[model samples]
Target: MRRPHRVAVLLVDPVVGFDAAIAPTLFGAAEADGEPLYEVVTCSATGGQVASTNGFALVPQAGPEALDDADTVIVPGTRNAAVRRDGRLDDAVGAAVARIPATARTVSICTGAFVLAAAGLLDGRRATTHWRHADALRALHPAVDVDENVLFVDGGDILTSAGLAAGIDLCLHIIRRDHGGQVANAVARFCVVPPWREGSQAQFIEAPLPHDDSASTAATREWACAHLQEPLTIEQLAAHAGMSTRTFIRRFREETGQPPGVWMRSRRLDRARELLEARTLSIDEVARRSGLGSGANLRHHLRRGLGMSPTSYRKAFADREFTDA
Candidate 1:
């Protein structure tokens, strides 16, 4: 049997307790064929007690040594003075971060990007943090491209997420990327969270709630998901919702933080990905079923969105049995 992937979460002093817990909870729930897929360990600079912003302390299971053989290393949000203020890593924290193997993927949640930036791990990379702190991050580390709009930025080897709940999105995304959508969806089901939220969705929505409580585009969204194989237009959707085209478009953007057409395209792409990962359908068949029109269209969108062909995506995530069901 293949060994489970090893994940080391390095908790900095005064860590955001919520951020520190997300990885262990989500990664622990991922499994294949009734076997765990990841072995997560919580560690700190010296294996000693660490302070948290939540009025408590954390006693990690290990020290910096845990990072030596880790497949991935994560840093949760922190209020560490040096890193947060002057963009300099604390000596002990710097040493701990340097111990992470060069090949190991690195991640940060919320202000944890500060630590990564201070360590120079995010240099010349596009990353994000909590929107409130985005300016500070950019001012401190001008070499890092800081985008505060999206929920997270996946820079391949170094990934960074926005505030608290966005951590869940990033972790699920990691699971989906590493295994397949099926495994990620199983984990999401167990955790009682939505299966997927596009990373490009706005981090701070101007109007998350509908102005009229009696009306919502949610049902229309569900209906649209069911009918993705058809060409769905704003007029048809508005007719179904008993609203004018303008109102439907406005409400759709207000509720989903994306315009109607963009949201629909993203949904179609998601469907195509699921088909690719879980079935043996031909490229054209997958395209038709997912409403992407043809093999050429599907290939175009897949390459444009994910930089991979349908066959390559299937080979990366296929043939895995999800036992969580």
Candidate 2:
């Protein structure tokens, strides 16, 4: 009989509940052809009950002894200000983590990154946290490259995700990478979550504040939407918002996590994606309508953003049974 992949969730004391529950809810549900693929266990430092940040506590079925057989180890987030401030792993917790076999992989959900950091696992690695805590995470572990925008960063053996639900996204992503898109999509469907997210944690914003009390960037955004086919530039977008370019640029970035030009391009690409999925329009027409002006430009961005050509993207989204031949 084939062995199920063993996953150990290392529960540090005073764990944050939201972070601790994500692994079992996500990876534990993953299956293949009606067969359970992962066996998930919760373990504490001494192999007994662990207290939560809340008043309650949890009885871990396994102790650190479970780490001996783990194929993967996940450190769920903690709310302890000390961990958040200094990335300090209590001695017992640190030793248990260090005992994982060299072949075993590791992951952190939310502020669980602190545990990983304190264990010296995240040094020289890219990581993230709740955007609100990103700067402090960096201040504590300057050796770690902190990117607050991405939902997760996959560094082969070590993975770290941003806040809360992003842990779910990372688990699904790991499942997708280990199995396939079809399986991942199936799990997503069963869970009633989106089959996929853009993955990057960056927010998409039209404007920072209302143009006036009457409306937010609604009218100006709509106007920009209608004129995407034009050579829509920062100057044009600013003018449409009835503001100077400097103010418009600042507000746009503050809101969107991207500059006006980049957001416009992303908007254009989103429309292009819709057209491609529609499959009613020819590739050239899709380009023209999405403001790329040519199929070649559309192909370039589609390949860069979606990692596929327009034809392939259309097929994947529009028809599972799609074939170019």
Candidate 3:
């Protein structure tokens, strides 16, 4: 059988303590048919007690050598003022980064993009960091395309995320990309997090914290997910959320970063993908169930969104019958 993918977490000095733990926890939780899919290893540039921010020290089992065989290398954010201010990685960290094989995928959480950009890995690539640090990252490396809005940017092999929780989003995204939607959804259920948040979703939403007295669109969104097969209109959703169409539209945009119609369409498309992979439903039936109208309509959306035909997608993704195992 296939060997588990090897992932190395490179703990640079004065790392963001919380950021250091995200990948290990997320990747460690991934499994398929009771077998783990990734072997995650934590390493440091110095191979010993690496001091992290918030008064914590991480004792890695190995050093830079761990990256030699790693199929993926993750650089968690650090609080080193020099790296952020001067746009330079420490000599040891730079050397360790250099050791990562060219074939290996690289990822960064929050300010970890600084290290990657400093090593010239992010040049001409779209990347992101914590929104607070986006300006600094751009100032330091003008060649790097920094977007401060999205949850994460998947640059094929080089990926970067916005901040702490977004790191979880990035890891979950990687799982979803590696193993189809069913496995990722299972892992998300195990972790008690949302199953899907597209990369284009905004990083921050106004009024994220709901007040008890305020009407929330959260319940409506969940309700909509259950009824995607129906023709869900903005007016209907607004009524469900106890607001006028204009008011609901404003609140929905504030809360989800996308207008009501866009968000719902994206959600329906996601459901279409899941059904395409996990079910034996025909194209017409899948289209009807996903509320994309008919086979022709589904074909249009799938081609525009995924650049592939339904038959082709099903052939590629319908490998194993998906069960919530």
Best by TM-score: 3
Per-residue CA lDDT of candidate 2, range 120-198, in tens? Answer: 7889999877677788888889999998887788888999888888888888888765654566667788788855543
Per-candidate Cα lDDT values, in order, are: 0.91, 0.78, 0.88
Q: Which residue segments of model 2 deviate by more than 4 Å?
A: 80-82, 203-325
Candidate 1 shows a clash count of: 0
lDDT of 3 by residue, 1-325 (tens): 6678899999988899999998898888888778888899999987878898979789987999999999999999998766888999778888898899999999999999999999999999999998888999999999999998998999889999998889988999998877778888888888898988888788783345557535678889999999999998899999898999998998787778899999999988888888988658999999999999999989999899889988888877655333222
Which of candidates 1 and 3 is the stronger one according to TM-score?
A: 3
Candidate 3: where is the Cα deviation over 4 Å? 205-208, 319-325
Q: Model 1 misses residue 27 by how many Å?
A: 0.8
The order of the candidates by lDDT, greatest first, is 1, 3, 2
| 22 Cα displacement, candidate 3 (Å) | 1.5
Off by over 4 Å in 1: 205-208, 211-215, 319-325
Q: Residue 282 of model 1: what lDDT?
A: 94
User: Which scores better on lDDT, 1 or 2?
Assistant: 1
Give the number of the best model, judged by lDDT: 1
* Per-model TM values vs. the true structure: 0.93, 0.66, 0.94
RMSD of candidates 1 onward, in order: 2.6, 6.7, 2.4
